[model samples]
Target: MFEIERRLYDEGHRFVACIDEVGRGCLFGDVVACAIILPQRYTIDGVRDSKKLSPSKREKLNGYILHDSIAVGLGRITPAVIDRVNIKEATRLAMKQALDNLTDKDGKRIIPSYVLIDAERIQTDIPQLGVIDGDNIVHGISAASIVAKVFRDSLCISWDKAYSGYDIAGNKGYGTAKHIQALLEIGPAELHRKSFISKIMEGKK
Candidate 1:
């Protein structure tokens, strides 16, 4: 909630909420999104992009957000859906799912008075602004980023045990050069986003 008032002015809206997603690049995990609205006076010390925080810090914020937020909702799009709709659309859908789950003080669903996002704009009825680095710039976006990232990353790490060959724990399923090489060596495991990786190699034909 700190440093977020500027969003009210610069975005030309008095009340702004933020939305963000994580795990787009992971080969073995669900994509997660979080939509968060915080009280104007709310403050969480050391809050930043989830990528910048340690696992413990992110976990702590996860609890803090659950306890302290004005409104918070999480949504996840599964790997099958990601493969079917592709990553970008699935990410937006997940964001909308998170948004749909949120409510204002009156116990009724309300569009964010204004919304800020880290990347592409979603064609929703709500008034929204897209900021390239929004997660770091907007506190609510940053908080959502933190929550979504921690949640998704934890799932990836847990999945590493279930699907061992791709080194999911180290790469988090991104199609790194090594990951691709491994895929070629062993062929895709059930965990790989076969469509995305397969596109690069044309189903390895």
Candidate 2:
């Protein structure tokens, strides 16, 4: 994983942003994306795909990534936006927003000379490469994944307070069996993606 990023560094790309997203498969809430730029050749131990890590582990890694990263930015697209533009475009939009948010403490924009995205081609003037399963194998993408996962999970926890039965916090908005049962019993909440639940509702009726 480090070797891939190291090669990019050797090629003179000083700032290489590794991008990844979370909640794309969720039945509620927003899709979140994160862009993380690490110092050249910097490697953090035990960093891997957020999906493979426990919640506690991811929370801890999130702190380390934020502290050690050269630049980190996050983006989120609401359920409304996802329904309006569709999930794929919404995801790309979030990625662009993440890139746009990259800046230093002085507020000067820190644009990446190169971008490494996880299996998604984004429209950007800056050069970018899309690698399949990059989050599992690429250190920087894994870091970004952890940030996105942890941030989105935190939001779900807050939402769970208002919307109790769906277990939004536990399932993180994924359409688990428990979540689907709640949706059937109570119909969709304001936060639920209507389009996503429509088919399930149809089946019930």
Candidate 3:
């Protein structure tokens, strides 16, 4: 997964921040994005896409990545903002925020020379490449995915306390059979994406 990043590094891209998002498909909660730049030649064994790892494995990798990364930043757009702007734009906004957060107090720190995104492009002056399924093929993007997934999942788990019975922790706000059934029975929670829920309700009616 490091091949493309290594090549880009060899080509003089000094700091390559790999970016990825999670919870875009969730029926509730926020869409989260993470930007991460690993030190050159730094890697952990068994680092893979967040989807391919167990929850425990992802949690472990998330900590390792945080501890080892040169710079790391996270962004999230809530369900309300997501409904107003739509998922695509909300995702882009989140990604941009993630990139913007990769700065210091004076805004002169940890900026990337290049950005490798996962299947999406953002409006940034920084040179960026949108790689299809980048989280699976690029080590940096894979690390970003792991971090984002863990962060978003923790949010869902916390939200479960307030919005119980939907199994937000287990389903992580996805439209699982149990989640959809809960929606039908209890109506949408505040965290539920109204745009997505309205369409499903319309279909059922």
Candidate 4:
């Protein structure tokens, strides 16, 4: 898992940031991105892709990753912006925002010497590499995945309270049967991505 980082280190790059995003396919809520810089030679046991981990495990590792990271930053792009720009472009923008927001324990900004992203490249002047399935094989990207997942899941919980009936808490804004049924009955909440749900809305009519 550290092999990629090791290679970068050998290439004379320190302070490498690994990034990943969550909630891209959701029908509701913002897309969230995370960027994390880990110390050289750092490795956390049991860290892998967030999708493969149980929610409890992810929550536990989220804390550990944050505690051990050199710097951590998060970015969120709203549903409106996502609708205007499309999910792919919104995801890239969120990644850029995450890198821009990177800050140390003392709240000082930290610019990474290099960036490693999961399957997508953002517009950045910093040296970057986008690895296919990076969150599964790269240590730092895996850690960032956990952080982004936990954070976005927490937002879903809060949104469930604010906007009921779609079961946002349970489905996490996915197009589950219950969520689709609720959309047919109560219509979409303000947070729902209109671009994503146009078909469902048409079906309702």
Candidate 5:
């Protein structure tokens, strides 16, 4: 269903990277993009979108991908930029940055001949295919998704320490009952997306 598979182009059995991203839906924190290329022999069972898997499973795969995959690169777009340019464009920029950092399995900095990218069209001059369910359909993309999610989750947990009252640790920077309640009680912090929660507390003001 994608050019990555349509061509069957073998770039001499190096690494065919599949790229994916997460955290775009979060009202707080940065949007993260991760790109990973795995060797042909490398395989992980039951890999799918990070959202579908348990937190434990995602962490396990993080280890697997780190040890087995080729170059794994993470890119983050900050909250300030997301506020200024919007999430869609920020996500695009992050994804592009992640892809631009890909390297071959042989440890050389080179573009993959074919790429399977989840959702967004990777802004690169390389031959790539954007698959709607790429993370579920492709193993490499699933790896990237797990890597990005784990990294972002850890970052959110860390932020919870510095920025109290947001419940970012429990909510992982997402809008949840605890998170919304915190906002109602104490209001938003610098990291919180002001536009997202203003409606919930509109009547209070």
Candidate 6:
């Protein structure tokens, strides 16, 4: 996992921001992105893809990652915006927002020397590389994935209470059978992605 960071460090990039997003495939809520800069050559045991870890494990790692990171930033794109621009474009915007929001522990802005994103490039003047499967292969990107996943999952709890009956907490906004059934019965809440659920709504009629 450290290979990419080590290589980049050798190439003189000190602050390499690794970025990833969670909830892109969800049928509800905002898409959340994270950009994190770990100290050069930093390694944390048990850090891997967020999808591969249990919720408890991800939460545990999230605390450690946040404590150790030089800088952390988060971005969220609402369902309405996702419907307006499409998921692909919304995801890019979220990632860029994360980068633009990067700040150190003291809340001062930190500009990365380079950016390593997972599977997508954005419009940024900063030198960047989009690595396929970076969350599993890159240390910093994996840390960012854990942070984004944990953050979005926390939001699910609040959404479950606010929206009710959709099982948002259990499904974490994914399009599960129960969640879909609820959508058909009670209808979508304001947070549900209209563009993503149109077909599901049509099926009910």
Q: For candidate 3, lDDT tens digit of each residue in 120-200?
A: 999999999999989999999999999999999899889999999899999999999999998888788888999988977
Worst 10 residues of 1 by lDDT: 1-10
Tens digits of per-residue lDDT, candidate 6, 85-198, equal: 999999999999999999999999999989999999999999999999999899999999999999999999999999999999999999999999999999999999999999
lDDT of each: 0.78, 0.91, 0.91, 0.95, 0.79, 0.95
Quote the positional error of residue 139 for candidate 4 in Å.
0.6
Q: Mind giving the per-residue lDDT tens digits that candidate 2 earns over 52-152?
A: 99999999989998988888888999999999899999999999899889875566779999999999988899999898999987899999999999999
> Worst lDDT window (10 residues) for model 3?
101-110
Of 1 and 6, the candidate ahead on lDDT is 6
lDDT of 4 by residue, 1-205 (tens): 7888999999999899999999999999999999999999899889999999999999999989999999999999999999999999999999999999999999999999999999999999999999999998899999999999999999999999999899999999999999999999999999999999999999988
Assess every candidate by TM-score. 0.80, 0.96, 0.94, 0.99, 0.88, 0.99
Candidate RMSDs in Å, in order, are: 3.4, 1.1, 1.9, 0.6, 2.7, 0.6
Who is ahead in TM-score, 1 or 2?
2
- C-alpha-based local distance difference test score of model 2: 0.91
lDDT of 5 at 73: 71
Supply the global lDDT for candidate 4: 0.95
Q: 22, model 4: CA deviation in Å? A: 0.5
Clashes of each: 0, 0, 0, 0, 0, 0
